[model samples]
Target: MRCEEGPLSEVYDRLRAEIVDGTLAPGAALVETTLAERYGTSRTPVREALRRLQQDGLVERADRGMRVRTRSPEEILEIYEARIALEATAAAGAAQRRSDFDLVRISRAQKTMTATPASDPAAMAESNRAVHEAIWAASHNGTIVDLLTRLNNHLTRYPWTTLSMPGRWEEAIVEHAEIIDAIEKRDSDRAYELAREHMTKARELRLRIYGDDATA
Candidate 1:
């Protein structure tokens, strides 16, 4: 079958989507020739895409060859801890620095997420990313924003199917609303606390759904 739009760009997008959606599970081997055939392209573009994934920490060169990076349970916990630190700091900064326009944007995104049906996991995930990215941008720290963007590449490996579980989407909406409320009030400490709490809870829920194997 022919690939979607954007030849080179589609190579990257397709591979990234597969990795993020868990089609290429963590620790799965990624043979260059197989990928090239699958995508109807030469190995050149496949190699380039793999390199980009490596730089993003989603893939790594292992003893066998290039494979999706696997995270141990301990490693997952560590990444979540780091997320707590970085996200809390970002939320604090955002609360202190966000403009009215930024607040409006965040509110709009939150509203969209809330209005989305619980059955629409893909839309929810995309909207969730947008809200978080808006907060990161409001912080006005390019360094932290860049770092978090990279970190999310790794985080995307985990299945977000948990968010679609019964009642979980509602819980997520409530959690996100609390976060937006804190940001709107400009309570930096509350905002930081809420952001950290939200991530911690998400990590726990994810672990519960997929067991230890889901982490990487």
Candidate 2:
């Protein structure tokens, strides 16, 4: 049986999309009445949608209203530390368990990431996500994938991409290629080390670019 989407679900999806894509922006006000007017719905559905988003950790209570959640520089660093551990594990698992089909998917995602125009940081960032997601899928670990997905949502709320920094895109391309090579060789240890190094480099660049922003 097919389940039909309700008004609340519709509002939730739209609002979540906006929040994740940086359309609403971190710490942007989310007023029930304003959102209701924008979505052409009553405040009832919008309120429920806000509640769900809050549960998802995408919305937070401000002094007098709801706003998009913001991560301080310290929090962002902590998230990266968690990602570094989990993603390295995923890369090692992929090297050990990936099938031919999984390799094919990963290769395709890498090619897409490399081919994306560097001038478009947004597109490059999206392509980069595809490569990471393909590698995660190759790991065959549902739990790792789910946790990374949730963490990535928080990271993407930023309007800027680390790939936009000078030379970062090129450097990332090389790092990704090396990681793929390690996985293709079925060198689990090598893959794990490479993945950790790759994420650590990214973490460094993120701090270099956004460290000045106290609320980043």
Clashes of each: 0, 0
* Local lDDT at 39 for model 1: 91
lDDT of 1 by residue, 1-216 (tens): 654332667798999999887789889999988998889888888888999999998999999779998866665687777877888888988988999998988888888888887777788788888888888988889988988898787777765555776788888789888877787788999989999988888778766765734454
Look at candidate 2 and tell me the lDDT of residue 111: 92
Query: Which pairs of residues clash in candidate 1, taking residues 3 or more apart in a chain or in different chains?
Result: none
lDDT of 1 at 27: 92
Let me know the TM-score candidate 2 reaches against the reference structure.
0.87
Across 104-133, the per-residue lDDT of candidate 2 in tens digits comes to 999999999989999997799899999999
- Backbone clash total for model 1 is 0
Which pairs clash inside model 2? Answer: none
Q: TM-score of each candidate?
A: 0.87, 0.87
